[model samples]
Target: MSDTAPTSVVDQVLAAVSELLPEIAASAAERDRTRSLPRYVLDLLSSAGAFSVTVPTTHGGPGGGAAVAFEVTRLLATADPNVAQIPQSHFVYLRLAELAGSASLLDELFGAVLTGERVANAQSERTGRTVTDQTTRMRLVDGATVVDGRKFYCTGSLTADWIAVLGRDEDDVEQVGFVRAGTSGLTIVDDWTGMGQRTTASGTITFEGVRVDPSHVVPRQRAVTGPHGYGAFAQGLHAAIDVGIARGALTEAAAFVRSSTRPWFEADVERAEQDPLLVQRFGELEVDVRAAESALVVAGAAVDAIASAPPSRVDDVAREASLQVAAAKVLGDRAALAVTSALFELGSTRSSDDGLNLHRHWRNARTHTLHDPVRWKLQHLGRWSVAGTPPPRGPQF
Candidate 1:
């Protein structure tokens, strides 16, 4: 879809998704109404090998790179934004396994991924004085690791098989530990009340002396500072989600204009599609979606390239990837908000329809894009343009 010839795995995955889209779309409204993702959809995705896309081929998986991930995310978001978003953190966990420097642990996690196990991220505590501050603690107890804290925005954990808890050790170093979902003393609260992306299940999780095996723990310092493509991978995934939302908005807008919308009485046009102003608006939205799509392709390719680069070139390649991804994120965020908001202007009263629930697009786009401030993204690009400075080492960069 982005002018690249997809590998066999990518092609097969896309074909499977195409076949499943009708069912996915048909249930999207109902799922949104309930503010929950259905198990059947996840089962279908597993059957299609969606979770195995990023697993290495040698690990008995597809090994689709970042570009394939972008395409898959875009397509899924077009069907259901919530469903599309469930894998964002899963991929991040997969990347973490690669960087964890524990071969046995990595192999175990990779095997779990191939077998359709989902990993949910438990980070972002509300009690923190600042975003970077963490009250979550990981400590040694009886020669075993234990994690204790309350985490909000624990996306996808409601149905996840494992939870990746981010915390700080006694030394104040950030660390991640994996725990089984039903582990004792661990509680996943379904209390997220966000106005958008309702089905993401981005709720709260409490870990009270939850045991974490030593092998399951990975220090996050290197992953945060090292020249891996994690940041770019994250940014690309978000950009693809926004792009998909914009595309979905545009698709719904065109359909409404063709069948349900009426032209302005004074315009002398028989149909809404025949109205020059409406046509101009559609054209503008199409251009925005196309621009966002192009940016995503560029950013995704940069991420894939940087991820495959040698260690000597990792820092430079990751820097370039960050710049590209920042640009793509800005464009995608803007396009999603613009397209979703503009959909209401195509006709009167349709925005108020309960059956359509069209407002979810804008809400989801607004909420998800706020994950990282776009102003900083622009500032990062500006600084790079003028000073040749790369983005700093951080997860959100």
Candidate 2:
């Protein structure tokens, strides 16, 4: 583990992130087979300062902003999409801290983030009619906030030091309750058995009368107020992760073909790499990967743009960021699905051997991309393109 200082130059930040990829990629297949990521990888990432890119400079961080942070996510995803995604909510809550978290709350959470302590999210419910529907409820009991509800798809809940639970209060407003892991009545079950992203631990969390500090709960109003860029940033990160999976799949496809795959008999070629059709297919996958990467670049810059815009211009930047992030989502989904599928197709039958576990990329891409529907993303872009209608402001958009 490299010890990275808090004040980050973009290059140094990227370098630190780069250093971890080889080790991560080397062990990725095995970890996926076992369905567990080592906890120390988080520590190594923290020690490397990968999680602090979004931390403001005033707080002894580099404040590398959205673009750099997405870049980090993309690189990590190429190694292990599960590990890459584990902290997605950690970053989300960092932005939430900016919204409704009190200054003291900010200090505590940001401090934990800068040190690489993980914060998991407990937001989506298993039985909700829609993504935003909440069955979990929070109410006041003896001047203390008491939470009771079950959350599913609670990604990273088991791995986190703290859990941020989204719930509806008596007033019917969505709010987040921050609870320490293992708090009484808080149970994080390792029940995630998704075909892909199997190690994400995206399972069920039950908050049965969990007591939460009032100050630890972020008010929904403040979190939703102002020129919101969290949606764009979050979506952009999702795009980055998908693109990384594509890149990883493409890379492994080429390597597996070169090392192990025999050319089709009709091709009359000694090497699969020399097969004209395989080469063409690889080229096509590369194009898709490039397009997705380019889209993320554009969208990430738009996310960065939102930080410095004046209040009058905030709406414009915010819309642009959302539109571009939506574009990234579309392109990313296409590339990840295409490239990961092509991996086995290009490498031939031996690639499917369970021992290689090459299928993990496609599995991860399929499972993780389900976090949001790409069709809705396309609809938003289509609506924006045809009528100049901005996407509705919400977590999904």
Candidate 3:
């Protein structure tokens, strides 16, 4: 695909996000210090239509597609990673709803999304030795579906209007059931103490016989496979987050070197920016960032194309999209880690200021990048390239 300027709804949304970066950056430190949700920032993003980036235009959303959503996510991550992460699952759930939900169900959820309501995911559980294994159960009880289980890494649940709980039905079929945020028997706990992305509210959520509407339950398999390329789209969002983190790190590095950093005594350069070694390091970092950005853009376009294609070709398109996204993920992970860690090298003492909290960038990158192992992503990509193998149909790829 040819690289062109972003236009239409994508351009509009990206412009809006760019305008909010200053304010988002201003509050980022405080939010990180307190590990509190940036509700004000989230409200601003919602008003700017950030949450509606991927919702269908027919459903009163911008309908900017996967590429547009990826751009928005990358911009948001640059300003505040915690806030950026809050909506990752929201997009995934919305895509799944569009792919598998019934007409009435889609209308209801999409309408809520357009009105600034958010959906949180309660999918990961500690009981499962493997990521795909689930102990959570959703069974029909007296004409109503009841969900009973505990969930960990339930990102964005604390502030969401609705929760999408992933579980297996009586027949062990994977399914997702939506429940209102404050429904009876539903509990959201802000207990996450991770080293990075602290404000994401990725904690434990408990559902003790929480009742779910029958219409709200959708088969996960249907959405995971279809013409939408939902898995690739989801992975693209993650890659965007990593790219944003890298960009943020590089931006900070440039500012500090030009203004506050001192040149090495032996080199005798007037400014840190003039130091040849530092300049070379910056050049190297910039190349890495640009390469990751290019990869993400291409992968995102592939996902968008697959999403818009006919269902007959979805399987083939999804495989290709998955391989592309896997490659992007690897690049994004390396770029973010390198840039964040390298920032400290410019001026270690000054960068260590308690208030600046520069280390948080590395912390966030290190923590969030561990969401999935990059080695496996590389393995999959290598397998695809050398052996003509396709990645398995799952969310992580």
Deviating ranges (above 4 Å) for candidate 1: 1-7, 310-312
lDDT (tens digit, per residue) of candidate 1 on 362-391:
888998889788899999999999998888
Range of the 10 consecutive residues with the lowest summed lDDT in candidate 2: 220-229
Full-model lDDT, candidate 1: 0.85
lDDT per residue, candidate 3, 276-346, as tens digits? 88889999999999999999999988997785677788778888888889889999999999999999897
Clashing pairs in 3: none
- TM-score quality measure for candidate 2: 0.95
lDDT of each: 0.85, 0.85, 0.88
**116, model 1: CA deviation in Å?**
1.1
Regions of candidate 3 where Cα sits further than 4 Å from its true position? 1-7, 310-313
Give the Å error, residue 25, model 2: 0.8
Per-candidate alpha-carbon RMSD to the true structure: 2.8, 3.0, 3.0
Could you tell me every candidate's TM-score relative to the true structure?
A: 0.96, 0.95, 0.96
